[model samples]
Target: MSDAAWPAPPQGSCTLPASVEAEVAILGAGIHGAALARELTLRGVTCALVDKGEVGGGTSQWSSQLLHGGIRYMLTGDIRQMREGLAERATWARIAPRRCRWEAFWMPHRYWAEGLAHRVGIGLYDHWGAERPGWPAGLSLGHVPKEAFLADPRGVLGPFRGATAYADLMTWDRELTRDLAASSEAMLLDFHEPEGFEQGDGGLKLLHLRDRRDGSARQLRARRWVFALGPWTDGAMAQWFGETRKRLRLSSGIHLWFDAVPGCERPWAIRRPKGRILFVVPRDGLLQVGTTEREVEDGWVPILEAEREELFGALEANLPSLPWREMLVWAEELGVRPLVAATGATTHLSREAVLERHARIPNLTLVLGGKLTTARALMDRLATDLTGLRCEASTTAPLRLWDGQAAEIR
Candidate 1:
């Protein structure tokens, strides 16, 4: 889609005021900050959300775009996280059903042991779905014979014993982030960079900001603040807050796009040779094949040519019949996963958001490491911790994020 055709997000004045004041000041406009702004605004708290770039123009723009329940977490014995994700998934379905929908995921296995594991995992997932009250039931897992699987995609898939199909969600992650920020009453200041922080009188916090558009200095004073910088957490903390103890384990992920191949519209979650998972998702007339993971030193989102070849190899390994190289590459998306630092590999780091309250600074919360699927709950916790606002389940859970065609009305 052309930039002119895209819905313009709710933005405050381009000319930065000499000084601005708000109840809360958020330092990032990615999914985490956007969700936090929405949560605070919904509770009648005024907010100023400042970002160095456009809203959802960072990692949020380049997600795998699946609002799944984290069924894969079940394999790691993180049942609580899985259930939390599933509950949040159900809530997203309730509020913005038009933006997201359940889609079938085909898991093809070459061996009986692998196929049995998939079946058991999916069966447990279904049973767990039943535990969430008021949520829709999960679709039953269907065992597809090898012949039927090959026939449906016109024998495009490589050889496999059989496959199991189940359901999760597919969404427009970038649009969802934009919609949340737009739907809120927070002052959205894109292209504004936070230079540094200072303690003002009366326990107020001062943010030194430079308006990126004009290179003009601006001041924002707020009683509370949140640093939801995602992958930029480490660098931002060091430069702006001066407390960088390595808070994030950065994992770079890349996705390749191609023309929508006929009969391959169904999404696939195939296990790669090293136990990593790759998704084949069809969205907006393009097929997105992604996501390879490796630990990185910085937050630079790069689509390395080596990684491109790796994904191309993965796609070829799974769907050898598709003429991927001959076809034009529709697009390529890349992002860094901001996972909480841990002792293990980057892939094993926690996807949960960590709320770091500054010991020296009062009423400031730093958010690190979160996923798009669980942003709402993370911000809800942050809201409660920062404001003592009672999170009313009746009001928050069912709040409509967007109402069909009127989604951009705000």
Candidate 2:
């Protein structure tokens, strides 16, 4: 495997002050951190949101960009997971309709059994999404005949009886994260790097931080601390706080972007013979094909040639007449998923969020293993845990994002 270096995260334009104090100080300005900060701010709590790089610069910026209802989780018969995702999907669609929209995903099936299974899955999916508060009515599965496939621009080569299409919401994950952070009353410290922390006299944590751009030291005092370090959670605890516990397993996912494939206006979900699913999504004039799931070590970002070839092979295998290998790649992205450490392969590991209080530090909370679709719900729970009061229904499900804008302090 050859190493293809990842582009450095963009330097944040925001600067830090000499010292800051907050009621709740959060580390890691990815989606979860941003979401939690927003949640607290909405509850009239002061928050300091700190990150080592620009906001949304971490794995939050790199995703398939689908607000899906855990379609793959259905394969494992995880109904609860599916329902949770669907509920959150509806919430997001309601709060940020301007930022996301419904899109149809078409999947081709080779055999009668395959088609039947897909039909059943779609039926279940539609049933779960029916009467969701803000989302549109559930859509029935649409079929595409083989004769229609012959005239398609994606150039399907193999013979197939038909295809099934269903609907899911597509979003700009990074932009949504930034909007949440910007709309929050939290003090966003984008380029602040945490060095260490110590206990204060009042049972608070005094966090040592350095400005990445100026190398100037600063301190933040807070009553509670939360680490939403994503893939860096386990190591950050060990390095900064000297706490050692197995908390997360890393899975690497890579996506390749090319100039929009002509006439491929919508996303396609394809299942290989071995049951590996691949997605081809077209967005913002580019076609993104991705996401290989393999166990990887933390802090690994280089794109391996094998990963590129694997994605290319999947596309080529599905659309043989298409020149997938010869096509020029406009860009590439690699993100590591922090899965809950388990005995099975990373592919089967849980995406459910885990909240752990530090063994010794009662006020320190560590968040692990959640996705873009479920971050708001996780943060809502975290907020409730920290505040010891249940959020009203209006504070959640009906709160409009990007509304009630907070003044910019960058």
Candidate 3:
């Protein structure tokens, strides 16, 4: 499936024209940009969506691919974030059913006290999501049988108290992102890198771009401009705003994939040392074990040999029965995410998306730190706040992507 080809563009349209004009010009084509394009187009605005590479080919594709309600956020008492994610999760299940599906997730508890606490916590999560459509009821198993878990032959090291199973939506992250971009009525320009831009007379923004494949120059003009450059936010900001204090703290996360365990069909939530959360997700007949989170100075950090071993060691400590080293596949992915710069751990930083008008550039907005599950909601808020367009209440439900015949953001 990894080798599958992306859908070709419409017939007779292979390259971007030399010059284009629109009401709005988007500088990135990740999920955020795609969603914003869709939202803006729905509000009767014309947009030009451009990307340095293929849509969703950046950090958007490297997600864990779970449209979960962020159960880990409950630890920090962030019920608002969890509720917002849960609502968005339900929205995805309702609108993009072909691209997303509900999957059962299990979090095993070793000690009785921990098991009880998880039950209470997950119950709260269920309560918060209960009002949303397609929300699943939580199931607390007091004594999950060994057969119910994908335990190692050596047996789990800790005393088995039970497991809690909950529902979360899973998606083909890259495919969904591409579909959103394709569905947007805006002009889609893949492989077009923004070189630089200058403000023209009368508040028009002139953006200089180059076709990455042929190195052909192009000019795009628009009344409004948006920077949804994700991990590249720092670099683009530095180039445009000229060396302001760092606004983003970058973090690198890496995931490794392995052939599925014989009977393991559901995803597992394993608690690592130091209270970090790791997930073993099963998708497309492969089990993906990940992810190691570490703060980095920039977004170009590579996955080291020691990081792989660290992931395996954590898996062995938690689920020692599985063949941690032997079932490894040849593919691994690494992605960098930007968080608000602060003095605490990266995990503690708010995962909420940041949308702010550029201080130096007129009619320019900068977007940072959004997740796949909450992208639509974030963009809806952006549309309302930036464009003064009120989203019709009916458009919130039964959303459709580009794959459907009648695609609309509302």
Which candidate leads the pack in TM-score? 2
Candidate 2 ranges beyond 4 A from true positions: 1-16, 131-140, 145-148, 200-204, 273-275, 393-410
Off by over 4 Å in 3: 1-14, 131-147, 150-160, 200-204, 393-410
Extract clashing residue pairs from model 2: none
Q: For residues 1-410, could you state the per-residue lDDT of candidate 1 as single tens digits? A: 01221234444447646888999999888888988888887788899998877888877887788887776686677888888888787777766665676776788878899889988988777667643233345444567666668775523547666788876777888778877787678876788767777775544478887776667788998888888888888887677656659988888888888888877756888877544788887777888888898888666645788898888888788778887788778788777888988898877777887888877676778898889989988898888777789556512443345335364431
Which ranking of candidates, highest lDDT first?
A: 2, 1, 3
Better model by TM-score: candidate 1 vs candidate 2:
2
The residue pairs found clashing in candidate 1 are none
Which numbered prediction scores highest in lDDT against the true structure?
2
lDDT of 3 by residue, 1-410 (tens): 01121233323333657888988888888889988887887787899998877788778888888887898887888889999998888777776766776766777888778888887887887777664445445544233465665353323554444577666778888877876776578888777767877765544378888776666789998888888888778876777557567778887888988887766766777666644688888788788888888887665567888888888888887777677888757589887777877798887787888887766566888887878889888887887776788767414534345554335322
Off by over 4 Å in 1: 1-16, 130-140, 145-147, 154-157, 200-204, 393-410
Clashes of 2: 0
Task: Give residue 99's lDDT in candidate 1 (0 to 100).
Answer: 67
How do the residues 1-410 of candidate 2 rate in per-residue lDDT, one tens digit apiece? 01222234355444546788998999998899988988897788899999887778778888778887877776877889889898888888777666677876877778899888988897788678753444445443566655555566663665455677776888888778887787688987777777878785544479888777667788998999898989888777788767677789988989889888777865878875433578888888888888787777665567898988888877777777668878888999988889988997777777898998877778889998989999988998999899875666523433334434334211
Instruction: Give RMSD to native, each candidate.
Output: 4.3, 3.9, 4.6
| Backbone clash total, candidate 3 | 2
